[model samples]
Target: MERKQHGTGEVVFNAINYTVFILYTLICVFPFYYLFINTISSNELTGLGLITFYPKGIHLSNYIQVLKLKGLPRAALVSLARTVIGTAATVFASAFLGYLFTKKEMWGRKFWYRFVVITMYFNAGILPWFITMMNLGLTNNFLAYILPYIVQPFYIILIKTYVESIPQSLQESAQLDGAGYFTIFFRIVFPLITPILATVAVFSAVNQWNSFTDTLFLMTDSKYYTLQFVLYRYLNEATALASIIKSSQGPVNMNLQNMQTPTSVRMTVSMIVVTPILLVYPYFQRYFVKGIMIGAVKG
Candidate 1:
């Protein structure tokens, strides 16, 4: 009887665990699943909220409509450039800064490090921050997206801790070989900390990819709008514009039966904005896991 009771309890426990895991996965995955189905489905079906657990009335018009939106191609190019360039620059800068802070010889290191960390907690308010950035010639410049985030304190701290774990003997040997700080950093330290650098690159790439506040405050021209910013404007105006377009049914060219709806266009844009980051994440997943594990080790 006890054996049977134990077996029953074990079965119940396994069932509960599996149930929770499936629900968790569905919770995480359902939004993207819904978005994809809606994007590929007919606009009328999407507008009717018919894309829940499964797709309905499939069509490619939503994707076609998205490509037709104004300034989108330019915005996409700008966002891609920003993500690549900005991520590269930020990783290098933060690693270098972090490496320097970890060194025994860096003068006033404690005070400087503390000051940088303080900026993480207490931001200069947006108005003042914007003014400062503009005064630094960031306004209307794509550099606005790249420069300010070059050496983020949070990333620097992570890298700094990771750098501290490197055997000091490596640096000592490099010093005996007449290596300068930059030489040791680039040749020796940089290669070994690939995990942390890859992790930081992921963070920087995501930030650059998703950023829109820079575009809102700094860029007045459509040429400089990032994908997220352009998409944001489209979202704000999409419903109203769609209503107008829907109402303007013509006898021949602009037929009501062939019209795309706002819902499908919005879902398509969301997929566009989200897909690149999603695709890139898997490539960095191993590095991210290793880096976090190593960084989590306490001094």
Candidate 2:
């Protein structure tokens, strides 16, 4: 193979591209880095705005103390349950509905797809939505998190577009082998559509994991609260939380080293809330662009 030679203009363009991307990456990463360093640094120094760019007086006590906070574990469990259940339900519903809509034999296919897609443009206002959920008995219910998100219009559209891009003959061949729609979907179409499904799953999981608004509106019970909601509350009531910690530990034993300042508490909670999504993002990143591009452009 012949090595391609770069012209001066091409060299300059490459330099600019690398510089721009590197700067952009750092800009995106700095906030998370800042939060992490602040959480691990001395509370006094953090409060004084002294720790930046790197951690100082490093200790794990902030995480330890935050974990010891009341209801944190339960809230984490609730958040995990909803993320798993909601993401699964959303993926399955999107795949099934997306496939179903592509079938010409299905009754009212166009109309139903249109009806579902139209939801992306508009919804009943919050008060009406709340009333509907209340009527449905979703208040303080775990199903509130899972049910409403199952049929997300945008996800359906993405899956539908990707499914349409699959060769029609694959489904035809499965049908010819006496496979029904469900069997065809499972045996053939499903495996082939993994990329798009992964993309949708990432999206659904993040949305489910980060959601706190539903908890605010529908949950009066702390038992049903999610980690995100707990974090939201922690951010709002950082001073109260610090006071609670201080009182629980006894003021006499508490020193500057063991203290839980509002700033430290806020940063620690934010870091805790953000870590999972950051960990999970890289896994799905490979499929994300390819799936979304095909889904968007082909549709």
Candidate 3:
């Protein structure tokens, strides 16, 4: 009787746990699902707020139409380029600096490490930062996207702590074998720090992909606009976007049911901005917890 009771309790506990997690998952996923359904459903109905839960009158025209918008393709390319380049640069800087900070032989090692870490505590304000960028000739330049993000204090700290967890004996062995610091770092240290580096890459990539504020301040040229900034413009200028869509399609194909509405444009653009990060996140998620725990907690 007691065994049966214990089994029953265990089943009940598992059931409650699963139920709670399922509800939480639904809460987290519902907004994305809602947006996706609205974008695919009849734009007319979606505009009226009738399409909820399951998609109705499903069509992919929203995505097709959104892709057709002016400057979207160019903005997408710019975003992709920055994400790839920025993530690579940030990871390299973090890893190299992390390794360098660990070496006691480097002059002013402690001072420099603390100097980098202290930047996290404060910002110099936007006007000063903009002036600095302007002075450096980075305003409206592609380097504006990549340069300032390279030496992130938080990422550097994570990498530095992670590197400290590595065995110094390994580096010493490489030194004794006549391998220089660069050789040891590239061949040994870089490979060994994959997990933490991957974590930092994900961070940098997300920052690069989602950033638009820098563009708002630094870029006066439309050619340099990023996808996120374009989305921002689209949202803020919905009427203009609608007019553009109509002008593109012309009067002949202007069917009321199939026509893209401002709501649809907003939701669709939001999904476009969010989709890349969602797709890329799963690839790096497995390393996220492991890297954060080891890098954060170990040291």
Candidate 4:
């Protein structure tokens, strides 16, 4: 290979570009690093909010204490269920409906599609929505998380734009082969839209995973609590009330005083909440970039 030489101007420009990118990367990653060091640091130091760059005291006790918190396991399970079920439901519903919109035989497609878009931009206030959820029996129910988000108009629009990019002849030929819309969609369309599907699935899963307000408002029962709500309550409420919150449904003797400092505990919870998405992101990173690029140019 030939050694390439850059002019003075090009060398200076490349140096500036690398410097900017390095700074941007550190800006994005430092908070997470701080959280990690603080979480594993001595509980007392963490509580005092003294941990800044590196851990002063390091041990696994903070994590152990957090894991021992009552009702935490159940709340985690609920969050997992919500993320998986909600993402699947949202992706399938949006893709199928979006595919239907691409069909010529669908009646009043424009108006119907517009109706979904309208709902995305407008909502009856919280009180009315709460009353509606009550009527639908979603209050205090696990279904509340999965049901309300099963059909997302923004995802549908993105999927619709994606579906429109596929050649019509392929679908027409499949129809001529006596295949129905469902078969064509599942066999011909779904496979080609993996990038967009991954993109939407990530979005749906993240939304469901981080959701806490829904639980706070709709879930009065302790059994219906989700992990995010548990974290939120811990961060905002006093530790003295932990025993009360943990056993709100029934009588139980418990002690939470020995739990790590609030900051350490908060860091632990942040790690717990964020770890799943971090683990899953690499698998979708390729699809995410591709989807955004294609959707931006075509959709």
Candidate 5:
């Protein structure tokens, strides 16, 4: 009887846990779901605020319109290229620095570690950074987007923690076999910490992909604008129905002529920008989870 009672309690607890989990997940995902549904919904239905859980009418016209705008596609491509290259470079650099920091014998190790950590809290604010970029001639260039954030302190710390957790015995054994630091790091340490590397790569990629503020401040050329900046410009320039009707030559139903609602545009832009990340997220999610677990356990 006690065994059966315990089993029943376990089932009940699991049921409640799953219910809560599903509810929380839905809460988190509903905004994106709404954005997607509203983006593809017909402008007429969207103006009525009729789109909630599902789209009332389907139309790809908004996407077509947005794509037709100048500089958007180019900006997207630029952003994509920057994200791939920047993530790769940043990951490699972080891993190297992380490995170095894990070794106690490295010269000026304490100072270097402290300097890296200090950067996380103390940033040279935007104006100074902009001035520095100008002096360096990085303004209006692709490097403007990629150079400033190449080395992230938080990511380095995470990688260092994961690297330190790697059993010293493995490295010692490799050294006994006449292997150098480079060989051990590349062959043994890197492979063992693939999970953390993936996690950091995903994080860096996402940051670079969604980046806009730096581009806005640093990029003077239209060609260098990122997707987010282009989208922001579009949002700012989107015409209202009243403005359109005033410019029209013929009489129009001003009341019935709906405004170009920014809500749908915002949603569409968000969906477009976020689609790649969502697609790539699942592949690296396991790595992030595994990395976190390993770090937490061994840290």
Candidate 6:
């Protein structure tokens, strides 16, 4: 009787926990949901604050207008290329360094680890960074975005923690079979830590995808502008009178065309910029969650 009562209590507790979790999830997701609904709503309805829960009128013209603006597709492609290549390189380098740090016999390991840690809290400020990039002739180039932040210390630490949790006996056994460090790392270690690598890849990719400041500061060439940079320029131009009357000869009336309601356009731009990450996330979500749980606890 007591055991049955205990089981009932545990079930009730779990039910309450699940209810709270779902509520929190909804709270977190509501903003994005609202953004999507508002983007498709008519500007007049949105201006009157009528687009709270759902779109008032179904109009797809905002998306069309955003796309019709110059440089949107090319900027998206630039962002996509940067995210894919940068994330892959970051994962490989971080995993390799993580494996190296996991070894107990490596010389001056403490010193090297401390040096990496110091970088986490300190950085050469923006001016120096800009000067250094200029000196290296990286300005107005795609490599400027990719190479500057490829290896992040926090990612390295997470990977190292996951690597440490792998059984040391596996490495010893591989050595006994005449395997060197490269073989052990490539053939044995990497397979076991696939989950953690996937998690890191997701984070690195998201960071690179949403990045705006770096591209703005480093890339002056119109051809190399990332999606976020283009969106910012579009937003600024969309609200300016010059943009509306660029092809017109006479002074443009702001009240006549009603073009100031570019809030919907901004929302549409945001949706476009974020759509790829949202699509890719569900595929790796299981691995990402599992890796976080294991890596965090193991560390």
User: After superposing candidate 1, which stretches have Cα over 4 Å from the reference?
Assistant: 1-19, 240-258
lDDT per residue as tens, model 5, 5-79: 458889899999999999999998998898888888866677678888987667665675556556878989998
Error of 2 at 163 (Å): 1.0
Kindly provide the TM-score of model 6 when superposed on the true structure, using C-alpha atoms.
0.88
| Candidates arranged by TM-score, highest first | 2, 3, 1, 4, 5, 6
lDDT values, one for every candidate: 0.85, 0.92, 0.91, 0.83, 0.80, 0.81
Shift in Å, residue 155, candidate 6 = 1.1
* TM-score between candidate 1 and the true structure: 0.89
lDDT of 1 by residue, 142-220 (tens): 8888888887999999999899888999999999999999999999999989999999999889999999988999999
The best-first sequence of candidates by lDDT reads 2, 3, 1, 4, 6, 5
Which residue pairs clash in candidate 1? none
Q: Give each model a TM-score.
A: 0.89, 0.96, 0.93, 0.89, 0.89, 0.88
Best by TM-score: 2
Query: Over the stretch 1-299, how does candidate 3's per-residue lDDT look in tens digits?
Result: 46544588898999999999999999999999999999899888988999988988888878988899989999999999999999999999989998999899999999999999889998899899989999999988999999999999989888888888888899999999999999999999889889999999999999999999999999999999999999999999877787788678889988776687789889999999999999999899999887877856543
Superposed by TM-score, candidate 2 places the C-alpha of residue 139 at a distance from the truth, in angstroms, of: 0.9
Question: For residues 1-299, what per-residue lDDT tens digits would candidate 2 score against the true structure?
Answer: 99999999999999999999999999999999999999999888999999988888889888988999988999999999999999999999999999998899999999999999999999899999999999999999999999999999998888888999888998998888899999988888889899999999999999999999999999999999999999999999999998887777776777786588999999999899889999999999999888888856552
TM-score of 3: 0.93
| Candidate 3 vs 6: which has more lDDT | 3
Cα error, candidate 5, residue 141 (Å): 1.4
Worst 10 residues of 2 by lDDT: 290-299
Model 4 agreement with the true structure over 107-189: per-residue lDDT tens digits: 99899999999998899999998999999999989999989998899999989888888889999999899999889999999
Expressed as tens digits, the lDDT of each residue in 1-299 for candidate 6 is: 46545588898999999999999999988988998988787766776678899777777756765676677889988998999899988999889988888887889888888798799999989999889999998989888877876778888898898888888899999999999999999999999999999999999999999889987888878999999898778667655523443333234532322333656666778888888898998888999777877757632
Error of 6 at 181 (Å): 1.2
Give me the candidate number with maximum lDDT. 2
After superposing all C-alphas onto the true structure, candidate 6 shows an RMSD in angstroms of 3.8
Clashing pairs in 3: none
